[model samples]
Target: MTKTPPGLPLRDYAALGDGRTVALVAPNGRVDWLPLPNLDSVPVFARILDEETGGSVELVPREAYESSRRYVEKTNVLETTFTTASGVARVTDAMVTGVAGRLPWAEFARRVDGLEGSVEFTWRISPGTMLGTRSPWLDRVGEHTIIRCGQLSMAVVGSDHGPASSDPTSADPAELHGHFATTAGSRHLLVLTATEGEPLRVPDPAKVDEGIDRTIDSWLTWSDEFSYEGPWSEQVQRSALALKLLIHSPTGAIAAAATTSLPENPAGGKNWDYRFAWIRDLAYTAHSLTWFGLREETHAAISWLLRTIREQGPDVLVMYSLGGSTCAGVVEYDVPGWRGIGPVVTGNPAQGQLQLGIYGDLIAISRTYVDDGNLLDVETARLLAKVADKVCDEWRSRDAGMWELEDEQHYTSSKMGCWQALTDAIALADGAHINGDVARWRAERDRIHDWTDEHCWSEDLASYVMHPGSDRLDASVLLHAPSGFDRGERMSSTIDALTRELGAGHLLYRYSGVADEEHTFVACAFWRVSALACVGRHDEAVAAMGALVTQTNDVGLLAETVAAGDGAFWGNLPQGLSHLALINAALMIKDLAPKEAHDDQ
Candidate 1:
């Protein structure tokens, strides 16, 4: 057996999904990160987080080889080609879907095809411990190899295109194994079918293999619906496709990112579980999907978000599960994290923090929905009004800002969010889409605007600062441009200040001091694109957007952060906010307004 490399870089993984759960396939044919049943659930294969006991499906050429991969045109299905000394093999990987949509259970398929000459291969299936639960064990029902982990059961099936070998059930680290060789035009496959608390059903190996093309067709059909033709059009479409993978089709809830604990700082304790749906992300997604005119995901996401917020809210939350549950508790494992960065964790602590910006997120979603020829349901409208009222009452208090920091303060961005929320609420009330105390909402909105101007703006830095105490410039304040807080002299100057303080070439750190501790936030740079266009810097926005799109991996998927110095991916895979920001920024740049009209508000 080839010794496992100490680690695989996050950039080396490609994502595949069925709009249900995501699986990250490493460059060398390893299924490194996948959560069962759902994206936020305990992972079935998570060698990305915990290298040793965190299991993976390993398939690699038996000889020294170099590999390259790309998504099958406009689809999430990945095709990786391995070139060995004597031959070549192509592997197609997908999380298959039925004709109707996502399968009731998860189905992951990997088809191996010989491209030239003949290539030898080996494969193994080792299901790991269920997060904090008992270790998995293998069983056999007829010829199917079933691995049981906690309440879940997975069937690992393979078909031979050559002679094979299998491990005895007594094997400790792995119980299912096979080896084979393929010549030109030859085909073989390995399929995994999983379910929780349901009857185990093993699929015919051929049918599972055929499901790869079926999944491809499904993704192509979905991708064809994207009508966006703009700057970064291909990346925009790919971002749309990547964002589609983060949508939990069963409930229409969008996860912030696919996996957890991938790390914003590899050497520090900044790794987080980003598998839940943040209200901020939902609002951003709803806003971005409008440009593509995708009705299903847009409506489903908006409806799911408001419904979940209504069920669990009077005071809004930062995030909720794809299943709409608000009860997420943090759990840390005793396993080594990515690259021996220990204390890998699940369930973010930020869920319970009072992030005041969620008010803006909810109201921003409502505004976008109504503006797009849609009307808010009466209950949803009422809930939004209640949020407006709460914002009016609580805008004075300090709370966790959009960054979800432990140090609660009246962050300028949070105040601007409150301002945007109340402003949008007044518009909704005037349009009769929602009923709110317009008089109070307007008064509170103006107060927030003036208060932010007086307290948050810094003469020394010539920018709206992170908070009153510090002169640090925050990239999040760039959202003020789209929120219509200011797109004039102050905003333009602030953009220049942020570009100098937080910008790292094409990327930008979240705030001033974070450059040394963490990588640049991917979404922040895209926000700079939108803010630039909003402030009449179209030439710069065009130039900036040109550089930022290349920051994504070759497969066109982005994580939450990127190392400014080396362009390595950080945080979690297929980050929703990053893609949403890309889509929105591209559209903003393409439809940028007359420069004269945007000059100095």
Candidate 2:
């Protein structure tokens, strides 16, 4: 066995996928984390989540070699090149695609082609079913192969999960017969489709080929909708693709990330599972999706979210599983932590927190929907009314803020949310919505705004404090600009205070240095960027935005936070909130860019 680098090394994984599922490809050519059928489902290949029992599918060059990898231009197709003493070999990985309504199927595909000289490689495939609970029983069936285990039966061809060896000829199975040479130019393919206990259908190779072509075409076609013309176009585009990969296609809900329990800090107890969808996250996602002209995704996320909130009643939970199921109870998994981040946990404790700001996020989304010509039904209106009433009754009550901290307090941002929810609700009633207490809402809205100004603002700190009677400054309040709460002199002052107190190098901490050594909140920085753009600080905002993009991994993937000292990625990776904030900040800055610049070129 090759000795892994110390500190539970991840082997430098990158993701590739169709819209449905993602595969995390490791540096040594092993696919470590893959959740089939859906993003939130139990992993079918989960070595990253559990290094011992969790299985993986690997492709390794037969000789000693160096390797480098990148995603293909403007697409999710991953290309990894392995260079041996003789020459280089490139392996491309992608998941096969299907139409929106196509059910009961999905694909994982790989193509290996030589670049220069004869290079040999080996392949090892071991699939862990349902979060490593079972291993598939593979049996050869003519040209095709079958993996039967429990409720899932899959037919695969072109590759087999055999024994592990760096040599190509170590263990030969019928399904494992792809050869690589300098001039041979061999083509090999492996696809796994979920049959879901139904009779398995053996399709022809030509159909599979067509599916691959159509999948590539769909991604290329969908990517054209992005209208960003920015300095880091490639990084922005890859961020968009990673966001798409994290989205659950069946319901159009974007997951927070592909894998969970990936740790906020390697040794810190900040590990969180982000596969669930939060109301705040969904709203941010919808805002970005709409700006990108993906109305379908926007509408789907909004509709699903609204229906889910309706089912869960007018009160919104902090988050929900991808299927809108509220069964996420945080449990520590019986496995080693990622990169030695102990206590790999599932479920989020924040799900049960009394986050009063969720109502504001919901109302913000609904207001945006109305702005986009989508009419609000009576049910949504009634739900908004209940939320507004709750805000009116409890704006001053102690509860967790947007950060989901354990210590409930009269969070200033939560107070701002009260103002936002009522403000948007009143706007909704004035439009085509049903009857609501517009006068009462307005009265309460103004009251909450005044209360925030009186109690939340601190003269000594020269910014809005984290909570009432506290001098601690929170970076979250920087969202006041996007929330339309404060602008002009007050906004400028708050921005200056935040820059002075919370800023470290280029990264912004969630609060002052006193807040438990928190990781530099990546999304909060983006929020600062958006707020700066809103306040007409275009040059600084663009520079900050550019710096934020630089913090991304080589593939333009971001974690929930980036360590300030060395700028290493930390926290949950490929974070949806970070991407969502990026999309909004990009648009906000674009809108603020001088029109003369548009006319100049």
Candidate 3:
């Protein structure tokens, strides 16, 4: 087996998903990170983290090769072409989707077709167990090979020559392997099916080939529904597709990202598990989906989010597991982190932290739903009103800011978020969606506005500070401009201040003091684009939007963060918030463009 080169940039991987789970495929033809059976499931292949112990499925050329890859138009199917000295070949990878909804079985298929002279190809599957809970053993069941680890079982069925020799007792065990020489017009297919409870029947190779077409058709059909016809339309559609891959089909709970434990700062210690749902992320995603007229996905996500809020009641946590349960405590693994950044962790500890900003997220989602001509159900309306009341009561309290900072304060953005929540609640009440104390909400909302103006803004800094008594600038405040917090001179000046302080070209960090520590947050940069458009900085917004979209990988996927120096992606893959921000910013740019420019398109 070929050793994976150390320190592979996070941007080098492309993602594939069936709206259930995702797989990250590196440019070198390795399936580096995949959580089989479910998005939150323990990874069956996690070479993205610990390359030694964590397993991977590789399909690489024997000879030295140069590679290029792209997603098939209007779909998540990845086509990577390898050009070696002898010949060229293309590998198409996808997580097979069912005709209607998600398939009952988790399926990943790869097809290689030769386009030139004969090229030698090698492939292998290395099964891994989760956190050492169970031992994985390969058993040859009739004509197929089954890798079983605890409750999860994966059946490997494909067209290949045979298994290659490998050490059976090693930490990195290869369960199956094969090699073959292919010339022009040659075709090969590999399908991996996984199930949680029971073993899967070995699938026919021909049927797996058919499943590939069906999956492609499913993605194209979904993409066809997108109504965007504006500037950056292609990038917007790709971002929308990336966001769709993060949605859990059965539950409508979209994960923040696909992979977890990829550090925001590669130097060490900022890694986070993003394979779960956050209220803020889901709200942003729902709002973005609504812009494209994707009512089914929007309603599904809102319904799931509302149900989660209703279950948690007045004291809703900041985030939840993908299944809508409370987040598990953080558990550090001995597995070496991506690029040896160490202390890879599962689960988030921020669930217990008080984040008053989520109230705004919830209310924003409800307002979007109501504005779309859909009335909230009785339970949802009541839950939203209860959340609005909680926001009113807790607007003055110090809590974690939108960046989830450890040092709690009366964050300027958080206070403004409360103001937004209360104002939205008054609007909803006026619309008669829920019975609420609108008079009290209005008074508290005004109070928040007054407090923010008095304490958060700093004449010395010439803009809104991070929080009361601090002069740090935060990119999060830019979000308020488009939300209608202040569209006049103050907000326009805030945009300029953020551009001067937090901005690194078109990208911006989350806040002050972390520029050298973490990568620039991609969502924060997109927020700047929206703020610029709102404040009539049309040329700047267009230029900034162009730069931000170019930061995406070749396949048009953005991560949570990008390196400040080289524009390399650092955090989790295909972040939901990043994609949502991209969509929103693109829409804003199109909406704010001059009539002649829009008509020309």
Candidate 4:
């Protein structure tokens, strides 16, 4: 019987999808999390949030077995090999997509193939409705089953996919439930789809097989557009796939992670839902997509941001729902958290905070567009002018830091963002996008920079402080190296001090001043790596990048942070900003590695 994967030090899970929806499959045969129809939809299977009560879809061989798995070439098709005393079995898993000119919002399919000797397999499909609050009642109709909960109706078609046997201890079932035995050269397919109108007729096995073949071909063709040929091409490609999976195809909204409240520190109250789109995520994603030459999705995401910012007004929330809906106040749930983390939250409360850094994020995106030869339209320019006016009016106000801390302070990072806004605004005006006082904007921009250098730096610490008069160092300053600030001896010394003080082996702490007991922020670590490379510290940068790559889960997916000692993952999994940082860091290392090593040689 397929036992729970040997409780080895299994790193976190990797993700795979067909661009429309995502599925988090464990190193074992269980699919831990998946939202139906789209990435932001209420989850249909949510075992990752609450392992015991929440539902999951498991496809396990009915034999004591060992297994290894990976994706099939350039596509997102997951292939696993199960080894048993009898023999071995290989199962290929994928959430099938439309093909042959079919509409994207169609059916989803998973296919299992048997290789080697005869292998018996079992599966369970318990539909979690109302986001794991209630399990749906199942009614068998003809050869199909209908699971109805509230307004959502899910249809499951196929035999040999159901609940586990009642042995309570039997690894192999005598009477199989949703169970089937396949010999050499045998194959099986399972299909799941949703319908709001009248129920559609279920397709036969022949049609399902055709769909599977077409879906595989479609993914292969789509992945061909990825032009990144780096030293670690496979890992980079996989990272790109993980980033793509979080994108909601219909609305162009990218979720922070597939699961929510996964916990920054296991058993801590740092858990927060990341299934919504943050403006910061959109800007970073735009930059990454521009680098990768995926302009269509990037433009769509930026347009989504523009619409959201327009509707939400200049006082934009930090984040919003996929369709631009406001996120309600966070609510605590009774679910047992990951590894016993407490206080799992359902939404993010940082939505309404007054963060001055967003102005810089918008300006950075606008600059990227203009640099890419894609002109910011007159309307976009006008909107940016409005944002700049706000920045000008509130440039001296104290607000939350980039970490979004509660106690308002004169955060150096926010001030730097204000500097970035004015600097980029001057460039936007040069493009004739708006009629603004360019001379005044330039003066204010330089003043902000001068103030940051004068007040935010500390002589004793020898690095930029988190805020004026604060002794703590923040990893966020590592970003200034790439922001094209004065990166001379002072900046280099500051980067080195940060490396020594906050670097937890490879992972870097977000800030040293705060009482935050969370994991080291993975993006900060990458930012430091990039800064090290840029400052001609190639040896340090290479070692840092090596250590960072080692922390990726078995399938090459990275969470927001890694535990300093235990190496357990912390924070949200497959963070977009983190992955974006990884790509940019790789680029920086590539450009600087040779120059520094040669200078020494």
The digit string of per-residue lDDT tens for model 3 on 1-601 reads 9875575788888999987899999999999888878988888788788777677888999999999999889999999999999999999998987767688889889988889997898988887656444567876667655788777788776776345544678665547777877789988887788899875856687887888888888888888898998889999999999999999988889899998888887678888889889989998889888988998999989888888877876578888888888888998887887878866888987888888888898898899899999998888888878888888889989998887878989898999899999989999999999888889899999999999999999888789999888878988999898778887788888888888888788888888888878878999999999998888888889999988889988889899988878888888888988988999999998888777767777
lDDT of 1 by residue, 439-477 (tens): 999989999999999999989889999999787878999
Question: By lDDT, highest first, what's the ranking?
Answer: 1, 3, 2, 4
Q: Give the TM-score of candidate 3.
A: 0.96
RMSD values for the candidates in order, in angstroms, are: 3.0, 3.6, 2.3, 4.0
Candidate 2 residue runs with Cα over 4 Å from true position: 1-11, 99-103, 129-132, 135-145, 148-150, 159-184, 195-206, 514-518, 595-601
Who is ahead in TM-score, 2 or 3? Answer: 3
- The C-alpha lDDT values of all candidates are 0.86, 0.74, 0.85, 0.73
Q: Candidate 1: how large is its RMSD?
A: 3.0
Q: List model 2 lDDT by residue over 91-165, tens digit each.
A: 778786666533456567666767777677666566664444555665656755566556666665543223222
Question: CA shift at 120, candidate 4, in angstroms?
Answer: 0.4
Q: Please report the TM-score between candidate 2 and the true structure.
A: 0.91
**Residue by residue across 355-405, what tens digits does model 4's lDDT show?**
887788888888887788887766677888888877887878998767778
In model 4, state the lDDT of residue 461: 79
Candidates in descending TM-score order? 3, 1, 4, 2
Candidate 3 worst ten-residue window by lDDT: 159-168
The estimated TM-scores of all candidates read: 0.96, 0.91, 0.96, 0.91
